[model samples]
Target: MSKHQKIVIIGGGTAGIMTAASLSKQKLKIDILLIEPSENHYYQPAWTLVGAGTYDFEKTVRPMENVIPDGVNWLKDSVVGFEPENNCIVTKFSGKVDYDFLVVAPGLVYDFSLVPGLGEAIDKGVVCSNYTDPIHTWKVIQEFKGGTALFTQPTTPIKCGGAPQKIMYLAENHFRNKRISDKSKIVFATPGGVIFGVKPIAETLMKVNERKDINLRFGHQLVKIDAKNQIAWYALAPNMTEVNPKELEISTNEGLVGIHYDMLHTAPPSVAPKFIQDSPLANQEKWLDVNLHTLQHTRYQNIFGLGDAAGIPTAKTGAAIRKQVPVVVNNISEMITSNTIGDKVYNGYSSCPLVTDYGKMVLAEFDYQNNFTPDPKLKQMLIFDSSKEHWRLWMLKKYGLPYLYWNKMLKGIDV
Candidate 1:
């Protein structure tokens, strides 16, 4: 390694750009290089509102050139392969670039094809996922007149677990607005037993479910979809045992384990990209293997990771990235100064603003330990306060959050 460090950041999404901004502000004597294939950088959380017809898709994205910090070098190319042994990454257009330190933030890949007939259903207007770009979500909702409108969550972890429910709430509200609430049937099918991960929110969601007349299909896994027949099938596991209230052992056999749906809003199985999957930096489970506390590579010391790519067992949301970026930036700085990743530790802090409806959200915050915590004392707390259904949070999601993301979070402005 040279006297001055050379840092390479792949994927200029939320994590990549924010880390760059944060590191640049520290004024480290280092050369920062960022590689990204996409010309457009998206505030992905905003896509949920876009799918609900509350915001425009065009407004959800900004040019990548604008978001990249002023001092860093931006490589407009995809990383085809990683040569972690050489401390370098091979780009598609540009050849190999070596680095003293590497930061991989390539977001998780959504596998829509994992569930049979999902591709066909998406095309045939029977399926829609907010996670995808060029989203036709509102069209899918508009096509639904009656019958069962199913929302599904896969066994695999997703970026925003709450997002599946967010869309469901919107669809339920849509049916109510159209005076079709009684006529339309809404159901939630999940591999998990509960609606929300946090208990307080889950308890509240149960009440919301009853009021909305939504059926809860627990221990149900989506296996196939028949777009032609407008039928979606899920594997049934009745009398399944689960730890309820986050700890108490309980079993429920009454809920429908296997249920069919007329129109399905599916959240596809997601994972780290194939390039990272093939690299040594990947965990035994095939995720980018990084220290849960430091966000530094477990096996490779020079390589660090954050965002959805990291193997940290937490909810992979932008809220999580907001917490992880600082830990990663600080630790990387320590590594540069001491020729090793110092003792800076991440508390495994991650957050998810569980948007129950257009106006209601339960801000679920917790550390990596999975211990239940409704609140944590961070400099900038993303609060999902007691106001489950309020115009204020809706306005925040609609107007304030994006402004904060672009101007503050992405720009490295303190919250």
Candidate 2:
């Protein structure tokens, strides 16, 4: 190892910022540089609440400089490509920025182009998505007169998989409050067969769906949208080829399932940023090719990837990154000192606060292999099982988590 080493992190979002904050806390005599173009940082997990009109959208953003740790060199530039073989990265304006170690945390990008009409349809008329604009989503919800409200997600991995239904649940509650539930129907379409990956959470979500009278259109993969006609079209998901032949949702003539909706909430297809797909670091799926447990680049020993762009099989939520940040930081420290990984390994632990109603939520905490691992704090606080809906979990989603994120997590305090 050299007498002085520099760590360069790509992206100013949660993963990069958290990694930088964590590294800075280590007080290592290492030069740290963060390459990011955005001047504003967003606490995106709160965007779900924003769309539901429970959270202030203005509060989710902060100046990039505010969240960045002190002493870390901030290179306000975008990454265009990488020269990993040479331990340098190509930036849009700065050209090549060399580093002794690199952390790829640029996160993923929404590819609305993947769906034929989504690019033109999103954030317009009744087609609104929190991923695009939470304010627009709130407006759409307010203007909805109540008919068929369709919510759907693509088969591709997306940040916070529970977001689609979270908004749906909120909207249903709103409709019921307005006495429109009798005249309105909530339809949730998803490619996955189960409501959630973990068995216990899945069961609970199933019961919530039933209780809310939501029509679950499983095995449906949204393919296109006709905004003019207000019809969302879906094809059978690749993994769901064996769907029941008697499924009435199928349009026999077109071989597609068409749902006429008054309102549409879409969780657009998310993919690794184009630069990552073009770079050598991406896997066949165009995601960061990192070890699932170690989070180190499969081919580059000095590189680590986390956050939404990582190809970890777990749900990409803030809680997942919360668990992953320490592993990356500790492993990097270990490598710098002993030239090897330490005992720290991320077990794919991720938690999603599933808001089932206006004031109730279910906390879905699980690890790799879809094993349910509820938070011990729930038991400590006498909150009992997290698989079932509780008001305290809702409070966490609305208040506690955000407080922890800004004051503790981003400050490098392990909460």
Candidate 3:
């Protein structure tokens, strides 16, 4: 069936719901349709705590119907293809949906197949990831008998870049409490050269790594896993420039390195959803092409994109979406009412609550340039230096943020 909406939102995720709710608050007298396939909505930021045995997994989720805005029409279907020229979408469950404007926030898709042996071994035995199964991760951590515990980060952009290491710190804390720290060797293998993007936070995290004795292996990417043999293989990233010809020559000859692990936690590689990748609106990188500042589609003014799917340079996190929602909503409303884009610009503001230990977190807020950008209100509310690890930030991560997300952000209260 072909039905038309004044505004059609693809994906009932954090971005879509907030946009609809924000629009609804304006009382724009426009019909909004939200398309999503999942029956549940997840508060993904808390997954790190869930994997570390701090937060409940059930609390991170809610019925999709419960969070959807009051006035928006919910289409319980997945979009298979986009027809931007006709201003309609082809869905798997619903035949066709036509719209005056479209909002794309379908988020990224996890590709386990990117790593050989990962697709078959994930959430099985000692191989577990917080992204897929936090319960299994907790179980893996619980059953650990003090050996090499390896946590890996993929080369691809993940939802929360700090998550791969968050659980590692928690596991280290767990092992210390269990008196197995001496017996366990915790190693963080990542492709990035530093622990974090921001300098101050990275410097602090470097010290945290030193304090925890967590071995950091930079310029390494997970290429394969041998679940049966309990071996994880990594490919060393090639040097871009041949500064020292002899050193570069030696490094280039290296092969896949293997490490034995008793416990392994990984954040799988992620990419744009196939539907978004196949669309005409996708950028060269296969992500939804939107103006980074305006959150408006570059090619089609009527289309807006946000959340993880938007091809923005900043780190993809829920906190980023929290800031992005208002920008997209206001611009869309202005366009509908004034027939011109809003002047308000998004400064590429995004945040990551880096959980350092059981009761401590480093609230890392930054902009596109990787400069530390703390929320003054958040700083005042928590009453602590956001750059330093504090229990207050942990409390915010464990309790306050989730509450704010459900009650205020999703409700379009704009906190």
Candidate 4:
């Protein structure tokens, strides 16, 4: 009977922590147990800034016990499997844990083996990734003299779609300030054709790319990394432009193009946790299958999911989680109180702060329909036209968001 839990939340990451805190703040007279294995809660959005050397990595993490809300109970154990039918979850250190309701928010993890040498090459030498080690990325960025600097991301879905190019833009600016602009060539090779999905944001970034003299290689996926030779190989991705992709400007060998680089910054392939992918809760893409708006499991009424692990058609950033948490919390609160969920629906809102240079950023906010939606409060703050780059947005990225995450969001205040 002690193993029977009232409300069990899997994962203590942003999603899990925020949900538990919000619920605890609601003063709901119920037991809530959060299951997580990690000892630290990371503020991952700041990693981009850390890679740019504009922010410190130490400030981005807090002890797990420090951030957990006062009332919510935390169980330091990893979930090995799930039995949604029986409303139960299996743990690694513990046995079967049954719960009246469950919240599955275990976030995404990396799988660098997708590329041949990426797993072994990352953070070791010239190959550096902010996702893995922002400190090493900064070190590599500073140590580079000048040549071809390659930036790329995997074809798989990542947390921030704009991160691969953010560091590139920062590094480009750094090179110019260091008097190496004439000798440096920055290249952004991505599987997607457009610089960004939103029309206004894409247009602005394309212009930024042009102004910085950076090459935008569309529909090129990182297939292999010959780190010893400092050669990055890419394949013509499925979305490759048909007319004339190569343009005969870069080197092409056999069917692949090998771009020799002085420094390479790339994100490893990311996917849902293995236990989740193998569980019944997963969709075809192996992510947690949940209603886009309600954040409730498509099949299991007593379960819900959000954050990077949810199979939502939106950017998997903290901003998206900001919108998702309210829906999940409200729906669950209604279910617990009235035995019926409310009409609180999430519009798939997500925001990406695209850092173009060291001190400049563009806040790209949109819905699931790919429409550019700006926050009205920005107008009150005398901030408008987020499609264009601004330092104020950079301020928000560097300081404002982090403040909210620690003071308000983690405590379930929601601003």
Candidate 5:
């Protein structure tokens, strides 16, 4: 006999756990099975702070068993394939598992191999990434003695678009505190033409760059790293076609340029997980093909998706998952009770807390259209301008948000 569940949730990350918790609290008496292989769950937003030596690395993780919602079955198995046509999933250990409804939230994968020599360079002298090991990142930053420090952003979509720069700002603060700012050359090399996608945030960041005396290299994508020689290679990305006088673009057609650095911090290129990419649920871009608003699968009515792997046009941050969890849960509830998808829709809301310095941050919140969409509740809570860097926002990032996440968000209480 095949194991079966009324509702099957894939991946126990933020999206899946939150969804399961929300459903468990509801009066709906459907049996829920969550398929996840990992033994521990991570609060990834804190990794940036951890890398900057602002937070403890251990605080960002917890036993997976501790967070799995009560009354839900936890299947410690990996999903290798999806049989959406028959409402079944193929797992590596459990074999075939049938479901009445399915939720896909396997998250995304970081492709360090995309950059030649990068895989071997991580956590090895002078080269580190917050995405991989925040502890080693802090170690590298602490041990730096002031030379050409290079921070890079990959061309591929990452979890937090602003993360690459957040660590840089912290390192700048660290270098300044150590009286090495004058001797160090801080460079931020990114593939994007603008410092930030949102114009207001970008303008604010430009001012920060000026204040920090950081060298901004736009239209540059990291391709390779010579770890032993401490050299980084970049390919010139195409210029922005949109004619905005306020925006600037590099007009160089130079095929490649190599820069020598004493220290390097980079986020590896991110892509959809291989299983999701190989599945039929994936779109042309290989992301989970879901209705952006409803979070429901386009082809399969019984399936829904959220989080980084979903094809939502917004920054893939934990704040995005916060808004998405409610939408997906409500829609699934409607489908179960009324046999119709709910009208509750996701607005593609995403937030990136850009840590500018030791105790200041610019809370960049936006929607699908890239409009500055700050949380009204957060505005009232902090009582400060989120567009500008403020210590209150930093406190929110450092203290308040973590409490809210562990206590509220994971428990499925919509904050």
Candidate 6:
């Protein structure tokens, strides 16, 4: 068994499943093992609508048996540890399997406990994050029928930068349509100074917030939550810093502050997985050490990674998986055959279709660099395109994208 040609993928989600399909479709007669802990695979992008009441929760999840490529062995367990040095991994099930190559794309885990009181608040119903399991987001939204419905963005990099605000916008829209708009006060508290990373889209979001009358708080970090009292505490950003040769002072910094809330939507900080973080393949920030261009492990050419697990400095989105899959596939193919590989850089490309209202969206796309410039001119770009409202985007998200994801992206078929 150990003598066969094999490629072991560490996850069965977007990257893992797609990579397997890509390889198998090429008629590569090799042993492939997919290690995933859960039987249910989630299309996480649609969770925003589920929180908003636009989409049903059941629609976002699919059985793993349906998504894993045929001819690949699916191990329904997690990689408890990785022995990358020996070209193998130890899974909770299926024991230790050696491989000719490894593709790590285990996604990410949300550490709610990192923030004091956050876990308690989430459990108690005062605070809920759409970025996590999302089972309780609806409850949190309903509980906030009035008074201080707060949404927050943390200091760490999140999966979808727009997700926190998207949930907020959806909730606001729901309130408006449900005749409860006057009761709830929507407040967006973000650690970032801007509403969005992309500037043009940020301008539009600012206008939307103004029109919706949602309060925007910038550079505020959520440090704690009081579930019993429905109060949240945060450290506000400093106004300015003064530095001298001998010392530096943050004079305008304010005291840690507390605010009352009827409901809260939180986005927790994220980091690389523990296994990758502990391995020598991690970079300075402890993310998977991969070449920015090839998506191949910097030190180990036979190793590659994508999705949130990869240390590439890009907006972590499923759309990112679409781009990275090609790079990893091509690079790994070249490495196996000992050929001069062509360089294919990801350009940090990721997209967050902002659902500003029930039927309006500003598609934001950009590279790893902060330069979030969209295609110079799309066929349609304006606020007045009412026919193509947020609902169309919602349809794309709910109905269209999933098919494209399962049949096209995961199967490695270019559509």
TM-score of each: 0.90, 0.96, 0.94, 0.96, 0.95, 0.89
Estimate, for each residue in 239-324, the C-alpha lDDT of model 6 and write its tens digit: 42211111111122247767677788888778877877887778998888888878888888788889998888788899888888
Please write out the lDDT profile of model 3 over residues 8-57, one tens digit for every residue. Answer: 99888888898889888884768889999999999888899999999999
Candidate 2 lDDT by residue in tens digits, 1-415: 4587799999899899999999998846689999989999999999989999999998999999999999899999989999999999999998899999999999889888778898899999999999879999999988888788889998799988989999999999888888888878788888988778889888898888888888887888888888988888888765653321222233423788788888999898999998999999999888999999999999999999999999889988889989999999999999888899968999999988999998999998889878999878778656899998999889888999999999999988897
Candidate 6 clashing pairs, residues 3+ apart or interchain = 348-368, 359-389, 359-390, 360-390
Residue 248's lDDT within candidate 2 is 28
Candidate 3, poorest ten consecutive residues by summed lDDT: 242-251
Angstrom error at residue 290, model 2? 0.8
Instruction: State how far residue 276 of model 6 sits from its true place (Å).
Output: 1.8
How much is 399 displaced in model 6, in angstroms?
A: 3.0
lDDT of candidate 2 at residue 73, scale 0 to 100: 92
RMSD to native for every prediction?
Answer: 4.9, 2.3, 4.1, 2.5, 3.7, 5.5
- Candidate 3, backbone clash total: 0
CA deviation > 4 Å runs, candidate 4: 1-5, 238-254
Cα-based lDDT for every prediction: 0.77, 0.88, 0.87, 0.88, 0.89, 0.75
User: Can you write out model 5's per-residue Cα lDDT over 98-173, one digit (the tens) per residue?
Assistant: 9999999999998888898998998889899999899999999999998888899788889899999999999999
Native-vs-model 4 lDDT? 0.88
Candidate 4 residue-wise lDDT, 227-311, digit = tens:
8888888998767752212222366788998888889999889999999999999999999999988989999999999999999
- Ten consecutive residues with minimal summed lDDT in candidate 5? 240-249
lDDT of model 3, residue 211: 86
Rank candidates, lDDT, best first.
5, 2, 4, 3, 1, 6
> For model 6, what is the C-alpha lDDT against the true structure?
0.75
Q: Candidate 3: where is the Cα deviation over 4 Å?
A: 1-5, 239-254
